[model samples]
Target: MPSSDDEATADSQHSTPPKKKRKVEDPKDFPSELLSFLSHAVFSNRTLACFAIYTTKEKAALLYKKIMEKYSVTFISRHNSYNHN
Candidate 1:
């Protein structure tokens, strides 16, 4: 014969635990397959780099250059013009 307050407390204690939030990794930060997937996105460097407040223009320029180089490599691979002598 438990009191109503005791029953309520027991019910609250038995409630399900909070669901664990899924951890999504940042694509640009990973340098994984996402790099290729997002290669063609317009203004992608500016957009993605916006995630961090302190990302400097120099750093953005370097990242954009690297991404462009990767795109050029992929292009040359397809066209066989890697060395246009």
Candidate 2:
């Protein structure tokens, strides 16, 4: 036979409230999630380091040229920033 304590415990378990569902932010809306992250994670920080994974130096150089052309102000003038691992 079940004890009185077991019955009380089972009753309390059933009475417990269900956890509220978490609402995830949609990325499709602009200023988009990409923009949101760029603003906070990149722009907010005065000092920033970027890394690129490429098959060859040529590929990395392509992006480096574009970044220099567009956002030269944000560029860190350090050879170490683009060091090979």
Candidate 3:
């Protein structure tokens, strides 16, 4: 029979791969869909663990602004009277 350490090594080699976590940032530092998803998750009142040390709130807000402009669906539409005309 193989040694206990050998069996352990074989087991480790056959172990399932770790789950991939979602990435929020990109190389260009531009706002991506993942970031937008996380921002929307805030509305769900769910606990979220974010590791966005490099990204700032301003960037996320800018992303949301871009999204709103593209889709014309504003979550806070009261102040955006420009759409009225």
Task: Write candidate 1's Cα lDDT for 41-82 as tens digits.
Answer: 455335342222224445766665666675443331111112
- Candidate 1 residues lying further than 4 Å off, grouped into runs, are 28-85
N/CA/C clash count, model 2: 0
Pairs in clash, predicted candidate 1 = none
TM-score of every candidate? 0.28, 0.24, 0.28
Better of 1 and 2 by TM-score: 1
Q: What is the C-alpha local distance difference test score of each model?
A: 0.49, 0.52, 0.53
Which stretches of candidate 2 lie above 4 Å from their native place? Answer: 1-55, 77-85
Worst 10 residues of 1 by lDDT: 76-85
Q: What are the root-mean-square deviations of the candidates from the true structure over C-alphas?
A: 15.1, 16.6, 12.6
54, model 2: CA deviation in Å?
Answer: 6.6
Clashes of each: 0, 0, 0
Error of 1 at 29 (Å): 9.8
Q: Which window of ten consecutive residues has the lowest lDDT sum in model 3?
A: 76-85
lDDT of 3 at 18: 98
lDDT of 3 by residue, 1-85 (tens): 8999999999999999999998855446434543654543344666444423233545667765665676544243212212221
Candidate 3, residue 48: lDDT: 44
Ranking by lDDT: 3, 2, 1
